[model samples]
Target: MPAARLPVYDAGPPCVSRAVDAFVRMGMAGVTFGAFMGSYDAVKEGYKGTGRALFVAKSAARNSLGWGMFGGAYMGLNCGLEALRRKRDWVNASAAGAITGAMVASTRSRSGIRVFGTAALFSSIATASEYLRPVQYPPTGL
Candidate 1:
């Protein structure tokens, strides 16, 4: 008797599609963060009505741009590093994210502490996410 063969499946979506999806997700996250921070800042500064709304909108836009750029750079760096090292690791991703976070913080304030703090926060989050990622195991024949 011949042995049974497992079925092969087609790979889902192209690389570009995956990249676009990731970019959109990161952009949305940035917008949300910006909206919250902007609203808080506006309130702290005593903004009212139209002023608050306008501030929030502007902040959201700026954040979207910053996050989109960060996402692109992070992905690019991760891919490039992986290609060179032939392995995927969180160091590249975290470093890219940290750099972008510092840049964003610098735009918001001139304090060195704030810039480094933001970079550290972002890198820590990235590392945590990487650590908590789901592991996939190959199927075992029973």
Candidate 2:
């Protein structure tokens, strides 16, 4: 027979640590994406420029910085929501994602449609991911 009660897992209080860790991890992904996209851009130019290599490097660095900033912002919002709501669940992730998406899009254009579109896109992605994530079970007493 199943137990009548379920054990709770204490992940500790919400702190800056989770945000910082997430930022670094996502930042690395940004770096990788930057490297590849930059290379592709350079290659599309038919390697005709004397500064092709330098162009690739600059593009990579710039893209990486942009993505890294996005990651930090997204995670910071997530962590803040988690702390404020006193819950660690998909609601937080979805909200954070929507806000972050809107913020990022607004940087380029202040159009309502653009911001709202991105917000919806991001929130959906976050919610889907949260739902797809595996359930975390409490540790065994043994």
Which lDDT values do the candidates have, in the order given? 0.70, 0.75
Estimate, for each residue in 45-120, the C-alpha lDDT of model 2 and write its tens digit: 7764767778677777777777777777877787788667767799988999999899988998999999999999
**Best TM-score among the predictions, by candidate number:** 2
Measured with C-alpha atoms, the lDDT of residue 78 in candidate 1 is 47
Off by over 4 Å in 2: 1-9, 46-50, 134-142
lDDT of 1 by residue, 1-142 (tens): 9644323232223335545656777789889989999999999989999999999999998888778767765555544554455444677557766876787788799999999999899877866765675432112232
Off by over 4 Å in 1: 1-18, 90-128, 135-142
lDDT of 1: 0.70
TM-score list, all predictions: 0.59, 0.79
| Candidate 2 worst ten-residue window by lDDT | 133-142
Q: What TM-score would you give candidate 2 relative to the actual structure?
A: 0.79
Total clashes for model 1: 0
RMSD of each: 7.8, 6.1
lDDT score for residue 64 of model 1: 80
